[model samples]
Target chain A: MSVTILYKEQPPFPVMATPDGDDLWLTLDDLRSATGWEIRPEGVCREGQCVPIPEGREREFVRESPPRFNLAALARWLEQPVLHDDVHGVWFFGEAARVRRETLRSLQAPDFRLPDLEGRMHSLANYRGKKIFLVSWASW
Target chain B: MWQGLYDELKDRSFVVLAVALDSGGVASAGQWILAAKPTYPCLIDERHVVAELYSMVNVPSAVWIDEAGRIVRPTEVAGASDAFRTQMDRKTKQVSAEGIADRQRTRTAYLNALRDWTAKGAESPFAVSRDEVRRRSSGPSDEHVFAAAHFRLGEYLYTQGHREAALPYFSEARRLHPASWSYRRQTWELEEPGKAGGPDFWSAVDALGDRSYYPPVTL
Candidate 1:
């Protein structure tokens, strides 16, 4: 299953678990909430996890469920922190869970396949028949 | 030691594949592996797929897979050698944290024993036989399974902008699986009445305000 975390004034952070695997889509709000400083392709920090928000095309959509208080206006009233991405018109809130629990070494590992920096798809099945030692670390 | 040991045994029908769980993606993990420059195959699991598959609760936990693709050993913290233990002991005392010595001592012994098994395979005295491994790896109970489902549902709802709706599911998950840090921490992360990064100031010690929800984490 997938989940999305959205902010009042920004886009949403979409975490989807597809049949093939899981994919993460960050809305402008997601980018802002994750990192105090927002710029597409720049780093956003949420709960100590830093995520890279790449620059992309922007789109406008209406909210199906508008609160009695305009979330965007309320966000301003509450003085909630807002960060902006360079390429997108959307704003971001910097208070979302940037890292999922499944990413931790303590959690059960899910099977997945995704392209590498070289654009090659890699999966756990590729390393079957050998002893595997998986270590997780990041630059930031 | 992992590299040295793996190299020594690779020719003997033993292969070591290092999987990196770095979410920063392959380039980040790749740099570290290259710096180490070990001979073994280093792989990356950017999202921690192996961790979830093995129910790994901590780093350095390892599973021994036999030739038949069965896990000869479930996830357990593999200790380093005796020499490494001595170095760790020295470091622990230097840091001087309370209980550090004891924790280090236990960790050292665990690692040393694990290395012994890694070298000896099933021949090592510490090596558990196939039957024992199977017996130890019985799946989580029906309660845990249901709790995991509820916890996932709660997380999903919380992500869907339904914080209020998510509360009951989180509560139910806590009721079903008290020992699971995932359920407890995820709920606790939300229940705190502040922004995401704000501290969890509520000292409710027992996440289940009602004692009937489940047992305490300490229990």
Candidate 2:
């Protein structure tokens, strides 16, 4: 059956889930949607980094009415920490440790592709090799 | 003075890329951009990617990257100049006297330090060692990382027109990173803008004690 999964990174929604004994499992798709990471052959991947998922995670979390998932396990697979509210069916994923470590070592600004007006695109790479004063301000 | 500084530094191979993190995209920052008529390449960050990636706690926060693409300075409060305090004072008519003073002190210090670093480059006293940069911008503690993710999620939801649903994530982000004014002010302005004018920046400061609003600048 389906159940509500409240993600710290997403609005609460009911997705395909299964009650596997006492632990609740979410569908593979739901897991990907709740977090921005994607399920790929190389494991779970975010924009610039990928970490390997344990063997059988793709098959393991797939099954049932929709399908259940161990979000905590997925968090571990991504080298992140997670908290679940069993009653409300919420999950919170902390940062990925491996990715954080890599970013720390590189000290290179995180790369992102954003669009400017006229729908044209811009990325930090465009200004690479130049001193950049990346300032952030909001109208508010 | 950003454009002025950019003009002077352009020949020196420096550029000031100012990004507006307004959720409303161009619409939000249009007036200021038009008024200033900046010559540099001004960009818009509707999704706040720079803030999330660079740990931008407040507006005018800046990261300085060297020619080699290494961050010479991590994200820190950067005013265009000391005159920023005068503009801020006029803008924030409601901030307590003490808060205003604190803002002036930090603003002048940050501006002078930026000038020193710009003039002296690596030789400047304000330019930190690589190790110190790592220490200042390290993992930033686990809570902050999660807070940033949640903040991004909230920004996405707000952008998607899910203001009501986006609130919890914003609240969580503020709770996790209490010192982050960008997250707090954005959400607060949406929820309850002050009756007189503007977001409740002062009330938020009051809630966190008078002097606790801004973190100490690394000068």
Every model's TM-score on chain B: 0.54, 0.77
Residue A66: error of model 2 in Å? 11
Q: What digit string (tens of lDDT, one per residue) describes model 1 on residues A1-140? A: 34333342123544331111111234445334533324333443434644343234111111223211122322233334333222222233322111222222222233446454445666645656554443322232
lDDT of 1: 0.44
Estimate the TM-score of every prediction.
0.43, 0.71
Where model 1 places Cα greater than 4 Å from the true spot, the runs are A1-122, A133-140, B1-62, B77-98, B190-219
lDDT of 2 by residue, A2-119 (tens): 5555443245566766655435566677777765556667866766778676666565533455545566566655556454434443344555645665686578777767665545
lDDT for model 2? 0.66
Q: Across residues B99-186, which tens digit of lDDT does each residue of candidate 2 receive?
A: 5676667666776776677677888878788888887785445777777666665665566566876778778888998877777776
Task: Give the top-scoring candidate (lDDT).
Answer: 2
Q: What is the lDDT of residue B211 in candidate 1?
A: 36
Candidate 1 docking DockQ: 0.09
Interface CA root-mean-square deviation for model 1: 10.7
